[model samples]
Target: MVIESLWFLIVGALMILMAIGRKFVERLPMTGAMVYLVVGFLLGPACAGLLTIDLQCDVALLRTLTEAGLIVSLFAIGMYLRIDLSNPLWRLTLRLAGPAMLITIGALFVAAYWGLGLAAGPALLLASVLAPTDPVLANELRVEEAGDDEPLRFALSSEGGLNDGAASPMVYIALALCGVHTLGSSNPWTFALAIAWGLASAAIIGWALGTGIVVLVTKLRTHYDHALGLEGFLALGLVALAYGATLIVDGYAFIAVFIAGVALRRQEMKATGEKPPNEVLESVERGQREEAAKDPELAHAYIAENMMGFSVEMERFVELGLMVIVGSVVSAHWQELLHWSVIWPVLFLFFVARPLGSSLSLVGSSMDRHQRALSGWLGLRGVSAFYYLLFSLEKAGSATVANLLPVIVAAIVLSVFLHGSSATILLDRYLSKR
Candidate 1:
């Protein structure tokens, strides 16, 4: 534990450096994730023998930590998102994210079952596990909340936001097929609960809670401000409560958290009692916008900004810790990555599966050749994939999952290195040039 604390201090310093000097860090091809991951590898028994973790033994703890990280990060993604869904581009996001994601899953399913010769259950698990793109790397990718967004960035960010939640149904379906859950022909009600109601319930509750909190805060601003300077911090409590409460009832907490962020902004607009409803909310945080005016609304906006700020800082740290832990988790098998089983699955998923689904989904849409290409190319997968696979592994405990772990880890490593390094460079090269 002392060794762990020391390592945290070292990584903590680096995180601070990365936070303040992102401009400097951005100039290098080396990403902060790469740095933290390397640190994790070195501290791990694979090298220095300072940190050791057994994946099979510690799966539950890892699952809880990773899931918590994914949830709050999802909330941050939702908080900053200011997409104009009425716009064709946002609707195009629905096409690219929803249908395109499913197509990717189907292609992967065939690859796993036919090419890799896995059983139906394992194949389904493999497909759904890798289906969602991540917004955890959003800041590095220059992913931002909705407002004056170009089609490509907006498409990727929005896709990352919704698809994380959308992928839950596929995971449940996979679980059912894996015989972990009780849903094969024998349980229709359970099927509806897992596939349909979970996601819908999260959305409704998220929307209601988000709207209700903002309205209540607006109504009792005097009581809120004087009694609690933490109206902003209150959001953290609310988000945590939202997540826990939703999950207790088996709702999709990820979607609920994200939707709550959006709902918060929407409620803010309505608290004024005259929203054009069509006009997008100001994307550059409300508190910062009203800082100069000192209006009655500033207090509310101020609290919201604090919430947003806290979420962002927390999300970054959580992502960093998870990557480090992941690096160490695979340390035991470090030298055995030469085989086809691991290589083939990752190779097909990244180069073949993702691109095929993404490109085909964008055909004849409003976007031009370049936007479609960039969107397809930037299907950056991360936390959401790991979260589902870990949860599934614990739930099913299939022997097939043992085979799946190395490939999943390898794919994520490949993605973090290639995609993280390229996020800024590619954006500048293609989008800037355009």
Candidate 2:
């Protein structure tokens, strides 16, 4: 009872501090994730002993919480990108999310399988889990606002949004190698077909659901002024619908949620007939609420803005709580994480695997060497990796996760410090050069 109460008290205090000191915290050299992580470590048995997490026992609970965080953040990431569908700027995003991502996965798999002497199953799982850049923690480096599509920010932001979902099939492949599912039981044709369907269906379902909801809400509002004043609820409902529908068809929910956000934004932009720069200064401010709603274009923009705001707020809240949990997990397992097996892979990942994959994928693109280097370096890993870790634990059992947990935790810890600290400075310099 005392521990439970202490948990509430500590969480409450942290929330209050965050609410008040967010601006001040933003100015610090480190990020909010770093601060929350250290606080969580202090709360763990290694220090204050106020909180303890059993990775084996709490896998289900942690998976659900982390999954929810990813869903919300993925949706928000989708909405952040306001670029037109035909914009040539998307070439950078596609290269990063598509080829760059696959190359990173392949490179990490080789290092894990050969350098670390792990079995193929575990090696692949580790690679898949760590490959995607985290959308949740990369908030500092993503688009500043809806219309702000600076190439670097847009590419990283969209890549973060796209790759999490894109990486799911690889994770399933890894699980199959461990005999966790029917994929391993089936033939190669079956595996290939299933993966193809999962990818195709997620994109279709998410885009349909996203565009459908926007159209529905806009029509209702046009005739009856309905669906007003609760864009938050609407956003959550859309995420749930897209995610649930995708899972029903065995599609990737992360992709569905992200695509849903993108589709909805595209539809909203069409409704508003407004381009990026025009909407930058016009927010869903209180004074413009009624007038904005009366005009169809403004109405769509209004709801889109409100939904983006709600999603961003939810992403931040989830980040603090989840980072604390990650910190406690680290505190409990620091000993296991401090080994050569763990050290080499992390070094190889950041220095060798990621840079090689990113550089190779981006070759022949117009981005300068400096921009390309920053893109390679900024693959921030956070909640998305944990989601996969807990997910693999649930399916592949403790043996697989045991090998993976240490390396994943170490990578995330290093990323939180290394990428988080340098992203702002590097990005600022890059922009200045531009």
Candidate 3:
């Protein structure tokens, strides 16, 4: 009873600290990722005994929790993206997703061979696993105001959201070749089939949920009497539905969430006639026209004011989960620091593999030289990297790779601190100027 009570207290305290820390980090121009990471390290076994609660043997639980977090984070990312598919932005997303991912994988594979002396299979596996950026962290860097309307910013935001889902197949394939699991046969075609199935499952589930919500909401607005806050509840329900449905179908829930968001946004535009209300939707429009008022910033502020806060809460929950899970996982394996092999591979991943891949993938794209450079530099590893690492290790049945978990966790902590802290300042000086 005492132990259980202590556990509850610790969780409650961490929750309060996360809330305070999130608000504090936002005002300071540093990222919440950095603070959470530093906090994790401080609470880890190396310092205080906060996360000394051991769970290393609980691989199944770790994988399940991490998977759930990944799915939630992915869905939220998809829902938040409000870009139009018909625009040039979609093309740019493909360019970044395709070339950038390929480059990162290729470069890391080479690095593994020359730098780490790893076999081709493991090198490729690690490269593919670590290639994508975490949208959960990337969204924190987004312009806060609605209608900030910078094309480049939208492109980066959408790319970050979609790239991880796109990279899933490649990561799975790499793992299969490394003899990790028999999700599919070793043939290239079989691997492609697995990818197709994952994507198809997600797409079908997302479309069903998205379409169902929009139709239901339309009916509610047209025929039923509902409160103003019902829309927000419906939105949250949609997110939950998308998550649950995808899991049931054995699909990638992250992809489903994103697709669902895109679908809902499309429906919104359709319902609203793709324009801000001139008179019918807003009484303020009449007053504005009478006064000949034309303040774009104020218009944006009004829209943001009317938006729901549920998405923000979802983002916070995912961020907290990432930090705590990372803390617990790392603390459990604190003894691995003595291993040079683990350390070297992680270093190569951050400094060599990712940069080279990003550079190659981004070449000849619409993004300017500065944007490309900043994007490469800011491909900071976080929850997604850890998720893949944990997933692979759990399936690998070997303690050799299992020992590397702490190193990866430490790398994520370092990334959340170093890159997350520097993103805004560096962007202003380098990419923003260009």
Give each model's whole-structure lDDT.
Answer: 0.74, 0.87, 0.63
Compared with the true structure, the alpha-carbon lDDT of candidate 3 equals 0.63
Model 3, residue pairs in steric clash: 78-258, 99-361, 100-361, 103-357, 104-357
Q: How far is 361's C-alpha from truth in model 1 (Å)? A: 1.8
Q: After superposition, how far is residue 177 of candidate 3 from its true place, in Å?
A: 1.9
lDDT per residue for candidate 2 within 19-136, as digits (tens), equals: 8988987776678999899998898888987779998899999999999889999999999888898986689888988889888899999998888888999999999999999999
Residue-level lDDT tens digits of model 3 in 1-434: 97678768866887787667766766566776665655665667777766664444666676677666665555555544454567765676677667777877777677666776766666666777677777677754553432233545665666666777777777666666667665465677876676778789988888788767665545443345222234446656776788788777657667787778667655544544445323323556545631222232222222222222456566667777667667655665656644676676667666776666666666676677777666667776777777777667766654435443555666676677767777777766754455
The TM-score of predicted model 2 comes to 0.96
TM-score of each: 0.89, 0.96, 0.82
Name the 10 consecutive residues with the lowest summed lDDT in model 3: 290-299
Q: At residue 185, give the lDDT of candidate 3.
A: 55
What candidate 3 gets wrong by more than 4 Å, as runs, is 1-24, 27-29, 53-56, 143-149, 226-237, 247-250, 273-308, 335-340, 403-407, 430-434
Q: Across residues 286-343, which tens digit of lDDT does each residue of candidate 1 receive? A: 3544331233544445445556678888888887888788778657667655577788
